[model samples]
Each structure stands twice: as C-alpha cells, then as structure tokens.
Target: MKYIPLRESKKEELEAWLNKSNEILAEMKLETNPKKRRAIIHRNKSHWRNDDLLNYLKKLSDGKCWYTEARFVAEYPQLEHFRPKSCARDEDWKKCHDGYWWLAFDIENYRVSKPMPNVKKGTYFPLREPAMAVCDPDVAITRESPLFLDPVNQGDAELISFNALGQPEPCPEPAVDLCEWDKRRIEFSIKRYGLDNTELCDRRKELWVAIESMISEYATNAKRATHNDCKISKGKAEQLIIQLKKYLEPSQEFTSLISACFLSNKVGKALYPKLLTQLLAA
Candidate 1:
C-alpha cells in the first residue's frame, strides 16, 4: 500500500473524540479489577466506534481498505482495531487472550480494513513468541513487537515486494541479511491479511499485463519507422506518461504495487524517466 497521509475530517473534530478517549484510558488505568476495567471500557466503546471516525479513516484511503486495498463500498469496511480492542486471538478465533481494552476507545488504535481479511486476521498479532513473554492485555503495547503491518507506517511500504503475477514476496532490500523479525512479519501479515487474495491478485496482474502490453505496442510502432531507436515519438511518450500517472492516483487500487512494478522494469524506467520521477515523487 502507498503511504496514505491521514487527513482528519473537516466535518468532525477528532481531537474532541481523542479527549474522550484519554478520559476512558485514564479510568481503565486506575481500576485495579480487570473485569471492572474491561466492563467500563467496553461499555464506552461506542464513543470510539463513531461514524465520524470511520468516515475520516475511509477518507484517508479514499474508500479503500487501508490493508487489502479492497473497495469499501462493495466489501464492507470495518473499524479494525490494530491491537484487537476486545482480545487477541490465534489464526482461528478458538484461542483468545484479554484484548487491548484500554485502547478500545483510542482513535490511534483504529483502522479501516475490509471484512474478509479482518475476519481472517482476527486478533492474531503474532510476535517472536519464545523471546517475547506473553503480556497482560493492558500492558501488551509496551512489551509487544507487533507483527501486523500498519498502512499508516511509511516504512511498511518497503516491507512487501510485488510481482507481475500479483503475488507478494518479502522485500529484497534486506535479503543479504534478512531480519528474522521482518521476514516473519511480512510472511505472517500477507497470509493473515490476505493481501494476495485470489481476486486482488487477479486485478493486480491485470494492471501489470495492461501496462506491459502497452509498452510492447509502443515498441512495435517504433519498429515500423526508419532510423528507429526502439523509442516512441515525443507525442507517444507524453501519452504513455499520462497513462502511467493514472495508476499513481490515490483512487487507483494497489498503487504501491503498480508503482513498484513500473520502477522494477528497465523498459518502464527508460521509457518514462520523467514520468518515473513524477510517480516516485508523488
């Protein structure tokens, strides 16, 4: 996923909602009884589960699921608590620990994900288990090395590598000395989040095939001309540039993958050097 800068909604004051969040967190922290604290916070979850917050988050991704790039309108959008607000679970929902109830009302803990992946993911926030101790749900945030990837994190953009087949691989940046933590996170997140769900992969492959074919067509046209350098005319170049830039828009699904595909190909880099600069800059 491309780095989607979260622009707070113009219709609502999120700071006001965050203030309510802080108030709830404060109460949860002070209560000694875990059951009482959970009940209190769970009771007030509606404050965090506001329409304003969901709308603001959806705005951030232009109605795309922040994780899977799924369309929010067709597939239902959920306010996925990155830190499983109720409880953390295993791959299946069978085993669960006390959820991060303290952050149940915290806006920062919220994200917009499609229902399918979110359900598959459930609360399976796997860390390097043996090395990391099981933390109390209340204190998990401090002790945990979160395996799930957050779309808001700019660094996550580099953690995944995409191919023309529309499948994801661990990014090759750290291939020589791959961090076990990162390798696990990427592998786990992809499987759990279903980033390469069959339908999603098919769409991504369509993009790759489309762009790849267009470039080949351009070459064929160039071959028909004398003194050909396997290059299109300036007019053709401008048209190609416009087409490539369309994928860079936020409205486009899987822009990070699209951008990566173009940048990885030598022909794409050479054909639209200026366009490459523009896409990367965006």
Candidate 2:
C-alpha cells in the first residue's frame, strides 16, 4: 500500500451527487428512529455510485486497490467507504453503532478496492477508543482514532512491511519504535485486508525471486567493471540499475514491497551506496 493523494479538483464533477447526498443527510438528521435512518440510507444508496467519482478515485491508486495494492483483473473494482455507511462494526465484529451516514456521499471517504477485501471489510471500522467514536454527523470524526491503517496516509502505509517470504508484517524497524497499540493496528490490517491471501503471497514471492536474481547479476557485473575495467560489464550493470528503478515507480503494483526489498537486501545495499544514489532518492 502507498499514500493515495486526494484530488479535490475532481469534486467539480460531483455537484449533482453532492446535492443528493445533502438531501439524504437532512432526512437522516430528522429521523429519530435508527431503523428509519437506515431505511433512508438504503433508499439513497445509489447516490454515491457516481461514475465520474469512481474514475477519479481509481486514478488516485493508479487503478489498484488502495489497501492491498492489487490491480483488478478478473474481479470488478469497487468504490468502498473508508468508514462504513450504514452500520459500524467493532474489532470483534460486533455491531457497535450507526455508521457515518453524513460521510456516505463524501468523496474524501471513498477508497478504490478489490471485491474480496471490500466484501471482507463490510461494516467493520474498528477504533482505538470506542468511547470516542462519533455517532452524530455534527461531531468531528477526527476525534475518533481508527485502528485500520489507511492507505491514503503515508505513515500508515509505512507501518506495514513485506517479508522476503511475501507475507505482510509490521515494520521491524520503523523510523520510531511502534507502541503496542500501533503494532496491533498493523497486524489487524494485514489479516483484515486479506494482504496474505494465497494468490497475492505467491505473486509477491515470484517478484522477490526475480529481484534477487537481478541484484545478484548486477553485483557480479559491478565487481568485474571495478577490478578489470570491463566496459561491457559496466554497461550491463547500468542497464540492470535502470530495470530495478522501474520497480520503484508509484504506478507499479506492490511498489511499497518492492522498495522495501531493494532497500533491505545485502546485494542491493552494496549497489545503492554507489550506483543507486539517485534511485534511492526517488
């Protein structure tokens, strides 16, 4: 997962959807009964399904799932609410309270996701402090600390690390040592987001093998160029660096993992000190 920058300019195309969202919010505010408010939300559920809005959200993640960094192939992608729309579930999957109905149509709350994780997430929006959970639309949601790691937040994305085995885990040495709470949050995100599903793990493993092979070949070429002044070996090493740099592109699938692998590998580290200075800066 990587940080997905929001494009507020795209909101221009959502005027009609926003207006309809306001109408629903108003009705929800007037309804005193929880059941009736849920009914109101169900009736207007289609308002958030705007095609333009979806396209904009997809662009933020380069057509990949924000949480898992999986590009859609066989399955159709979905516009998921970072926070649930109708009902909120706790860490234990217990129904905790009414969802963030006001933000149901808020474009900022949307996340582009794959079908499996989207369905698995369902209404679950666990918080660090349940008591601080916002029940009313008027309350600032910023007060509530969510346990889920948001792909849109660079810090949250950095909390997760992929192992050489292709399993997702908490970063072993984060910039700062993570507290117990933060560690739990990262662990929860890995399991809940389906980051370790079989297919994804296998694909990541394949990538790791490929990267390892290239790094080894680069090391062999670099040594020959340095000791024997071999021009051909120098050219080959330069080309290998170029190929490795492509893996770091933001639009590349599993780029965060690719970056982690390159930065941590012993052979990669040796190359980075000299030839990979500019690539590391990127």
**Cα distance off (Å), candidate 1, residue 170:** 1.3
* Superposition TM-score, candidate 2 onto the true structure: 0.90
In model 2, pairs of residues that clash are none
What lDDT does model 1 reach?
0.71
What is the C-alpha lDDT profile of model 2 across 168-272, one tens digit per residue?
888877999999999888888888889989899888888888888899898999999999999999999989988877776667888767866877888776654
Off by over 4 Å in 2: 7-10, 13-16, 270-282
Best by TM-score: 2
The residue-by-residue lDDT of candidate 1 on 77-176, one tens digit each, is 7887777766676544544456666667766677788887778887776555524634454454646667777776767656887888988887755435
Number of clashes recorded per candidate? 2, 0
Each model's TM-score, in the order given? 0.82, 0.90
